[model samples]
Target: MKRIVEFMKRNYKIILVVTALSAILWSFIPREKKEDPEKDKLILELLTMVLERGHYSPVEINDDFSKKVYHKYLENIDPTKRFFIQSDINEFSKYETSLDEMILRKDISFFNLTNSRLLQRMKESRKIYENLLSKPFDYNVKESINIDYDNLPFAKNKSDLVERWRKQLKLSTLSSLTDKQKLEEEKKKENASYEEKSFEVIEKEVRESTLKSLDEYFNFLEKELTRDDWFAIFLNSIVERFDPHTFYFSPEDKEKFDVSMSGTFQGIGARLQKKEAGVEISELISGGPAWRGKELEAGDLILKVGQGKEEPIDIAGMRLDDVVKKIKGPKGTEVRLTVKKVDGTIKVISIIRDEVETEETFAKSSVVEKDGKKYGIIYLPKFYISFENKENRDAFKDVAAEIEKLKAQNIDGLIMDLRDNGGGSLETVVKMVGLFIPEGPVVQVKAPRRNPEILPDPDKRVQYDGPLVVMINNFSASASEIFAAAIQDYKRGIVVGSKHSYGKGTVQNVIDLNQFIRSSSFGDLGALKTTIQKFYRINGGSTQREGVKSDVVFPDRFSYLDMGERDEESALPWDKIEPAKYEPLQINYDNIILNSNKRIATNTTFKLIDENAKWIFERKDEKVISLNLNDFNNELAVADEKLKKFKAISDYKNTYEFKSLPDELALFEKDTVLKQKRERWHEEMQKDIYIEETLNIISDIKLLTKGKSLTQKLSLN
Candidate 1:
């Protein structure tokens, strides 16, 4: 078995593995560190063997690859262009095209030299920043700093490096000046007798804060990290060239990955590790914003975080907990993560924040009444399923129960709010879609080098055949796209939201690397996840890149961004085969849709929505920003003023009213937290323009059907 597995590992190229495996046998041999180069070489050889044989699409390691890896690894380490000067680049340039050769020979000379230089530069830069912050800056100077670094060249000498640090420090103080000015103004507004600190004192405090952040950053570097951590970043940089999703997880990274996956939906969904160089992403939660965005991945280093439209605050050497605090914010808000990719390019990605929900707060439904007609709304956060037991806490079952309760209320319409529900269990999605249509093929799965298999809804019973609207946005992905595409293909419901859902249609399998090596006793080999299958809609069209399109599209905040599966460079391309033989629903609401579009075109909410989308789009693409305080403040004020016109957007109201079902209401009375969550949900739903519009359409459907329930009307067929 061991010999056969070795042969397979040496040649096999399309192995599918899961994210975590418990098949790890006991081995006390401690994992290798870079201190012992021979043992580290063994781990590398094992990893290379696995990648060469198991990755879906592995590239040959040639001089071309070596050059790519060299540049990418270097860029990943020094993304800010501050630490390494032109001469440093020249010295390292020789190895830029020789890195792949070194990998084959298991040479560590390049890493040894670069790591040493980076440490030296870090120490040098620390002294420069401390010295500059030691003295007060003359704020009266009209000097400006260029905020964008994309077009700039590396500093040619030490003096230039010092200038770079000076501008960065000045930018920090400029922000502090604005904040202090605000604090003083607010104090005076609150009370006429209030006293405020002077501008000089505020400037001193701001400089002190910056120095404190620096002190803590240096403390972490000197204490908690090592050279091996930097080398791990280098290894991952090499692997990522295969695809955005492929990565290398150091032993420490694997542990962090397990812990973070346990509470993934709570933050930006990225597991970060502190390293001798900076902070690197250990792994991203499967369905979190980082995974969905495609720009972030394991091995990529987080350079800074910019809140809202503010310039990014450097967190390269900052403490891990403090870095996390800046990333985590209230749901529906935005936090920009400035990350350095394996290739060294720096980009700021904006993610709408969210958090993990408790079981009781995960999924809920409400009833909205319109024109004396009642409609039911079921908001599924994700297609959750418990793996421990067969019948415990399944999302499909909870949704079915909600449907039954809505039917008892004699509801006129039903809406499944799947906005920002990244995706979850495939089985639950298959079962959930079954509730709306008759038993039929739901999704098609295509494994590597195999014919596509049609996964059908095995249950023949239709749970709800009424007026339906399924909501989705850019964040709706994987299984969410599966459900939305099936419903759209069946023409069973009117799909609504952004242009389309996130187009992540490929299925991934992760496996324990140790399972492949037995006698070697080389300790833990971590785990590897590989893409194994492509998912297609029932109509035979792949949802890999071109996700399911909405019937009624709206100008959502993400509409203008490069956020879909198509935007992912490594995403599988869309394709088609013979269409599956399944019948769409026998209902027609083409005119109702046209009526809704007409109303949508003229709606004030959508008008401003379009304008705001434009604003966000323009803001993101701006190539230059002034670092001068007056110029910065003036520019920000203009944007803020424009945003004021849309203040009423969140407060828009209609005559629609929402209420919980009797069972939930009774249950909520006993659980105060549950009650509060439901009340908050109801309040938000009332303010949702999309929900308001949906209620109108559903009410129109009721009028068109002459007050007959949709299920009853469908019975005539």
Candidate 2:
């Protein structure tokens, strides 16, 4: 550890010196002067108009304040600029006082503060003004002006007398009601006809309702003031001082996010979700310790966790983060959880936490048979690999191995499933794409004032030569986009799935918190994730706001949800540059769509999807009926009947006759589908209809190539 610290100290000083020099240079630098006075004046006029519309009082024109803000704005605009130079900065500085005056007078001509730096400065100045207005005021000693709780002027001072006066004014306003207020006051006029005694009953009901409302308001406030909330807010405040991408995560959130990103964690292997009753087991991760134990099942609500059955720790009303911390322990430790099953049975299950290896998250392959032809299917959960670790375990290498194994089995075609894969290592993605096509430009990257550079495939050889199809969905993003773009650009395979992928093109670098505070007065402030660069396709279009559009599209339940880059707050803007020149791949897959549409039109599974979507849409927000025992039983029966009908439509029995293959071929096929329902499970794995469509396309490609080969042989004969 000491050696490691020494090494970092030796290398990190260079970065510190460079950063310090840049900051010092920027602080003293004179920036460009504004050539367009009209533009500058328009910006100022706009700011004034916005202030007036918002009912914000303008700041008094102070030359010192204006000059200080203007200089700060210049520094923000071009932090690297040094020496007394540049006309734009100088010109903007010259009109600083005039801008302040225009803002103070609420001039209509001020409307052009559109630049980011200028906007930030204007916001800061407005905040200063508001802070000044929010100061406590002395309401006790009033001149002739009317001043009460409801009609008090903005305060600008803090004093003990002011607090007493404000409280006194609030009490007086309640005591002395105005004519308008009295006219609109709540009255028991309806009860006057009934009796004077009935007024007491009405008053009690109104008081109870008001009390309930207040109780709910305070409950919400209490929940909002949790330790986690305060910690999150503090972290955010610290991160906000730096770039928008830089962030801090508490230990719990950090653990969760790390688990999601890496797809590995120390747990019993059950996926949990917060349900109405308690944390319920959603699914059992295959090959996990929990799955091996077979003691826990999906839909079992965990009520308590305990050690040695000594009084269980009730987890009701506990935050998910807190619950997770309690459940996660070192490997080999046994933690018992009392669960309530859906069938109304209670059971205590002891689970041992262990390191769950997530092979499912990597590349897994299977053979699919449709219309008496076999197609290889490779499901890649994410383009993930820990590059920092010395262990060479990588996604690209694993995927390449899977492809080679499929090749050895003499598969006719291939389907690469990328559905719900929210991307990872950019280096791995480029290498993965290289497995299909000969080495060429896969992507391009550009930064401010820098020429765009092409990121080419590092390898020169193709791993698989047979027909190929790439599957994607709405959740597919970043590295996924890069892979899809490369495959599309090369025309090496059919790109099929949702209409567009999740457009997350920005790259983030995780800066250690300890490293950041090493030279500062504060020690170990926590980690910071800073956005370093952006990703672009080889075609010059960014996959930022506009993700990759598929050649064939499929429907998904989450299609209506706002889940992409455009929906994200503070996402970077999308733009393009000159297209990089490259020859497109020679493969043809136009017939894939024609065949897919025909199959989908007659498919019963797809028909159920359409019907279910319509049903959900119609009953999306229907309130539950408060029914008696008989009516409740009747409602449950109706719901069960509807579910049965939906299930029937989706259940398709296999009717294709099996042919006896050669002994070697038979063994290979048997081993692939040794488990019960293997064929059906493989079919469901191709849930994205567009991916199924792609597989069909690959089948057609194989036939077309085979036909051409036979024709050439006949011609030679």
Candidate 3:
């Protein structure tokens, strides 16, 4: 989920100010060193101090909290219960209730013990997997393995662990064998003379592939991760006991988070994925320096990275983040990359780093026609902003620009799609709500022992006054919820989508942990993102656990699943305050909602989606899987047979043709990559039954508005 952050303002300084910490901890400071345990201790002390003083509602650091952190840290490190055995757990269990004391005293004995033991266990696991994959499995063996890891106990001994590893590998290989056999049969059906590989040959090939994957997985663990990474996981377990959104971002992770929030970074602009061979380019951002150079292509393995005139360092086995750090630098600086192309050719490509904007993160609009009238859909991926530069491109400015473009097209209605928009800047959301309604209170923010601060749009200008719709889904969160809740409270627009948006109402502020320390000898102390406040709707309701429910609900595949902020154990409870004084827009959507629901009840695609949702809920906990080839194939055949009834859901398509706005058409001539992306989006939109129903709702609203206006004209006559 994206963070909804409130930047450091004057008032917030009072709560976070820890001026006395420097004087108190001065004697405990250590000398300058590359890696220091003393630095870790200092960070822990600083984090707890800030959390206790500045967090909106901090949980007490008692034994109960210690037990939660203990289990959570262990579960996060070894989620599948493959690395640690019962003996390791027994050894670690002794300190489960004492972690709170350790934190209080800045002692890391528990963390150090677990970290070393995990490393040892991981080393032993490599040999176990290697030995198991060296031989073939007997598919004739009739056995089943429970895939549920949470309830499964740790192995009793080393031998039991090895047996556990064997069964897991055997299950994987057996599934692959059955799939290969089926594909061979399909090839024979397509061409009777086609030569198929032997069953034993395919089995060996699958085993080799599985072995390579394991090698890469272990290689990442050994080469990429460090002690600090594990320590960050442990730190997060401590902070998250306060709430789910509170977290500790390592220096490397903090940089990444900044890039995500801004959606612009100075870099090569190519996404990389680590594989067994090396780091491979997944996609080159359109209009980026690498894309402009036209030399580096996706699937090319980056072998080395060099800055300016320095000698290139081999990155064959280096961590991906470190490799990225070497490649990305200040704008106009030269970086050379040695890459192996997909055709097995080696090339050295030098490119200048520039500010690359991720286009997908911004707002874009599409125009579609229905019932002889045009409607505009503006898709906002997040409420992003550059906290460092005010003039930089942001969600509010881009969306306002899109609205003007749609106005130029003379569209009758608008749809603001916030599906999967986790959220971003809180300030941006307040301004974005101004685009739809007149100047009014947008949302309410409350901190611990502070009066409610009512944020409003004071421009007194409405950018779009026509029929409007705000679309959301289960994944839409924080700032998205604020926008929807405001619109719903004002009765300015119809909120439509899954039951409600993601319920994340709290606000986080990332504090630079190094600011409180006077010593540069300890290096960067990373950052702490703690929840310092909770936001409420203009109508006095908070969207903490109960998110902004849609005015018109649509059945979705995830309808019955437990998700969103409500599912988080440490999520803040829902509450309310006095409502902000504001007048609701004079628009009634009762008929509009009623009409949409009537149509949804008869829609066959929606009915099938409801059935699919029910089917998914029924099998949500079907964890026991067959390890035998015959039984596995039988189970797959039965599932496939049952899933045939739902195939029409994928085949369902609408007749509406979505197209890019007038401005994007001219740019598409030089930027074919962007054109291809828009074409794919349009294709997906055409098949979206939810969008089709949304268009119908907009049509109903338009008709209602027209009728109301005509009555007013008659009265004037």
Candidate 4:
């Protein structure tokens, strides 16, 4: 390790030179200038607008604040510039006396300082501005000029009110707080008469409220800090000197982001979030302590967690990070959580800490009957199984086991629901696809300047070769797309659901910024999420800007929402590559389409969805106002009426009453849906309107095959 370190140190200069050259070359590359000057201008305008008109009370602006904000913007754009260095600082020092005047005089040329040195000075100016704004100010003061309170309405409570006030105060007090201080002192004295309380009571109240208020304030601060306006400014300062992805993370944010990306942390295996009322159980990770205990459920709000009943710590208004720290401990330690169930009942659940196994994220299936026909319904919440922990129980294995159980029931068709599945392990997806396809490449991954690697099916044998229908929605992404793409490419199954999946085609590689930073300067900073690779379908089309368009689209309200990859800033452009070669499975889709038309025409659910979509569109942009008490009540009545109409249309099947096949009669069921699918895989491959259409196509093929067999026997006679 020492030798390797020595070698890296010795070759560090070479690496830096190579990196610098690459950066220079990439910067100059004559690619299509996708840079939107309008967007850049809009960003600048937005920043200016936000600073000018934002909720900051007693809004004020000064040359110092303007310069700092401007510097922040520049830094966000480019962080690695030498303008942050001492030499550049010294250069800016020469212009220090005239800098404010230059800014006030609107001297555009003043900004034309050399890129490296100017960036450094801008960074310094940004810090100065931040420090100036950080000083306390009177948020309640109303500015005569530039009064904007657009976001003030969104403040729902006292805490939100305070946040709005703080935003205004920060803007107004920018470098001019002496007057504000005087006003605050005067206001305090004026209020002192009405607010007469004993000093002891006041102190006690202050001390008691401090923690809760601080927690609320920090929560608000976190949201404010993460806002695009603030983040852009923050990043602009640092990124100007480093890579675009490099970022500073507060300790709290760093931990949360890490847990989000990794999906596992050293905890009791329960996901919790701080809600308006209290800390709530977001999810009980399977095989985790909470999950193994089988006492907690999603939506169970946590009131407290402690070693014993008496020592319970009230977690109300606590930051999620802090709550997590309290709950998580070394494996085998006991932690008890007092929880309120969704039904209004409260209970205490004790769980022992252990490594959480995220294998059961995907739901297993069993055969159920609808109109006396046995069907396999596999409920997949998210296409997740840990690739990092492949040895033990996982999604693929569990799903396979469920499929086998369904097969034992001799089911005719399969419904693989991908709705709300945000996607997970690419490896599990490949293996899951392999269960359907007979040993072939499932998906292709392409990296920069490298040939695409094909992830082939892991299994050689097919399992339960039946009519397969993949259910998807707008939430489906990444691994979900991979599975859908492969199934579609092979003509293996029909895709069903929303207009398209979430277009998250590119992958992110997390870089621990703390590791790269000089330890002496900043300690334990956060990580940077950098775009590393893009995933493409085996058929060459990317699930990038354009997500996977389903074969059979379903109506969803979110269809109108601008959600997915294209909406994200700095998202990589989408393009196609040469398609991978594979043997195409011939399917008779003509009949399937014909059948789909008939089913869709008759399906009450589809009709209601269409009507709902139309209604939604009609009122999409309608501004609702309810000033009077009667108007508010009437509006609510109208909303409830609409909901009632929807509920009336919904034909909710009794899921619990749905029966599974008995074990005794399973094997001899030759005419079952599963048997027919295996017999007619080729014929059904074409008509995948939904998996049911595929099944219908298979049934037709079976009839055709049976007819041909009879004809052959008659000919022999």
TM per candidate comes to 0.82, 0.56, 0.85, 0.54
Candidate 2: where is the Cα deviation over 4 Å? Answer: 1-229, 237-246, 251-263, 268-354, 369-373, 389-391, 519-523, 586-588, 617-641, 649-694, 707-717
Instruction: Tell how far residue 137 is off in model 4, in angstroms.
Output: 26
Q: Can you give the lDDT of residue 136 in candidate 2?
A: 30
Report the C-alpha lDDT of model 3 over 1-717, residue by residue, as the tens digit.
334465535444434355555565566666667456777887899899888887889899989999999997887777667789999999999999999999999998898999999999989999999999998888888888986776889899999999988987887567657767888999999999999999889999878867875776576678878888878888988998899888888888897877755557998877775543468775565557887786897658887676776645545435556667778899999999879664333567899999886786689899999999999999997788877788988999999999999999988998999986778888899999998876789999998888899999867787887778889988788899999998888877799999988899898888788777677687788999888889999999999989989999999877887767887778889999999998876666888898899999999999999998888777767778888888888887877776788889889999999999979999999999789778877887998999999999988877877623211112110
TM-score ranking of the models? 3, 1, 2, 4
Q: lDDT winner among the candidates?
A: 3
lDDT of 4 by residue, 309-357 (tens): 3345555434455677778877777888868664333466887787664
Quantify all predictions' global Cα lDDT against the true fold.
Answer: 0.70, 0.54, 0.82, 0.52
Please report the TM-score between candidate 4 and the true structure: 0.54
lDDT of 1 by residue, 588-671 (tens): 778778888998999988888877767666766564556666787887678667767866775687666789899988997688
Order the numbered candidates by lDDT, best leading: 3, 1, 2, 4
What are the per-model C-alpha RMSD values against the true structure? 7.5, 17.6, 7.7, 16.0
Clashing pairs in 1: 12-53, 17-509, 17-510, 18-509, 18-510, 18-511, 66-100, 265-356, 266-356
Which wins on TM-score, candidate 2 or candidate 3?
Answer: 3
Q: If both were scored by TM-score, which would come out higher, candidate 1 or candidate 3?
A: 3
**Candidate 2 local lDDT, 115-231, one digit each (tens):** 433334323433332332233322233222222212232222323224333343222222212211222333435344533334334333333433333333234334443434333
- The model with the greater lDDT, 1 or 2, is 1
